[model samples]
Target: MSSTPESKPSALNPDNKKAPVTNSMPEHISLDKWADTGYEWAGEVEPSSFQRLATVLSTDHEQTKTQLDANLYRRNNVLHLAFTLTGNVWLTCQRCLQPVAIDLSDDYDIALLENESQVRLVNEEQDYLLLDEIITEQSPERLLPFKKLVEDEILLKTPMAPKHDDCEMTVEQFGEIPEEEESENPFAALASLKGKL
Candidate 1:
């Protein structure tokens, strides 16, 4: 979606000058000012760049990357974050226990809430993004780490039990099933003993 750029003054500067924002994604960002100014950030990041995400991946294969775009704006005095993430990740297949390539692409729009009390104010009409104290007040300048948000979205999109459409491996691959040999039933022996008695 495209909108005509509004001529609002930069929140960082009171002189109505454009804020000098970098093209490269920042590790942390201020949501309040960013949303008020209608700022947008886009970049591509490797899965291995995120420590939490890296641990879940089957392998750190090269050439796999996630393209992300985030747009911040205010709606009805509420901060909103719109995100788009697209990439391919290698995950362990639950069925075969081998690496399975999974394509991830999703778009999400969520309102940023200041506290749990604010969550109750948000109607069921929209989704809300609640910030923990650690990410909000505790962070320097009340900025949140962008990597953590990106990693969270990727994790949410990942399947709980990943499996290929057509698995090459079968149950036999796990282990061999022993042949069943016929044996006399215990009930038959009891019957024989009863007859002798």
Candidate 2:
């Protein structure tokens, strides 16, 4: 496998200018205004920190496309993000190195912590966080890292190389070796001795 670095944790920082961007996604849309309004975010999930967890499944002829389905619930200053993801992706087969299509469907359950004093801290110890109330400052974008997770799962499922189950080696593939020359038993003299007995 190629050693090109997968996106790093620092690359996820929305403020990181060093992150390489091949595709352009509009700067994150804020969740603050949509919080109490009972609106859901539905659009093309891009190559952001959260979206990186979810691999967009597609073919060479298609682009990365995704749909975000979620219910936003707020109570006692907590925001609950609940959603599902559906998409397809093309991955190299481990065995034959051929392109294979992998489909994905995922459910997301996340909560954001909130406090009034405008205090925001990322506790690596926790899986979720407090949501932001405004778009002015850099807030962690509420994207689910579906792609990366999917890629990992696929890696565990795929074989080292892909081949048809019924495939057999052709004569040309066997090359010039004769069947007698390929025999494993070198003790032909023992067989002759048994015949003399």
Candidate 3:
């Protein structure tokens, strides 16, 4: 494929690891173009920038940022992506209902395919993603929402039920389990009236 004028030397060079991250990195891009051109991008986005994540956050993160690095290239005519997401976030502790700080770090090397028919392109060492599942909002098989993709990775890393290893709150403090008290049954009065009748 012929290179576009906007494609820079660093973007053209798939092995250029030292290339600096730029503000020109787009939140979304054409998956076809990125793989065809061997595009690479790196950036840090605030955790608060994530719409779904922001609502679940329990701590004040005015300064925290999630680091994201993505590299897309074609090998043997199959597109591959090397992606990383690392950052710290705070979630509500299920035990005490307080903020519990968590550190997230993950790395993924995945094969991108348009459908299940292309699954043979991937080997055992790599994971794979079907465009049919992820590219719903955009074009059928072209556009990729990179920002949401990274956010999804972070969400996967988050604990399902987050709680501190050592909770400071006592049993009474956490939430008191109501004690069952012995009481008269609701049907007792009816039973007595029925006997009298």
Name the better of 2 and 3 by TM-score.
3
Clashes of each: 0, 23, 0
**Candidate 2 Cα misplacement greater than 4 A, ranges:** 1-27, 44-64, 75-77, 114-197
Candidate 3 at 153: error in angstroms?
1.3
Tens-digit lDDT track for model 2 on 1-197?
Answer: 11111121232233422222224222332343344433343444432233433343223334355454445555445555555666644554545544555554566555555654422343344235344432235445554333433334434443444444544534345456665657556688788798788
Q: Which ranges in model 1 have alpha carbons more than 4 Å from their true place?
A: 1-24, 60-63, 116-125, 132-140, 171-197
Expressed as tens digits, the lDDT of each residue in 1-197 for candidate 3 is: 11121322444655543333456446676765555666677766677788888877886434377676777767767777677777788888888887888887778777878678777777877778887787777455577776677677778878888889998764556677799999999998898899787
lDDT tens digits, residues 1-197, model 1? 22222224555446653434564456666654554676666767677777777877886345477787777666666766677888789988888888888887888777777777776656787777766643745644667666577677778878888888898765555578798999988798788799687
Best candidate, lDDT: 3
Global lDDT of each model?
0.69, 0.42, 0.70
Candidate achieving higher TM-score, 1 or 3: 1
Residue 24 CA displacement from its true place in model 3, Å: 7.6
TM-score of 1: 0.70
Model 1 pairs whose backbones collide? none
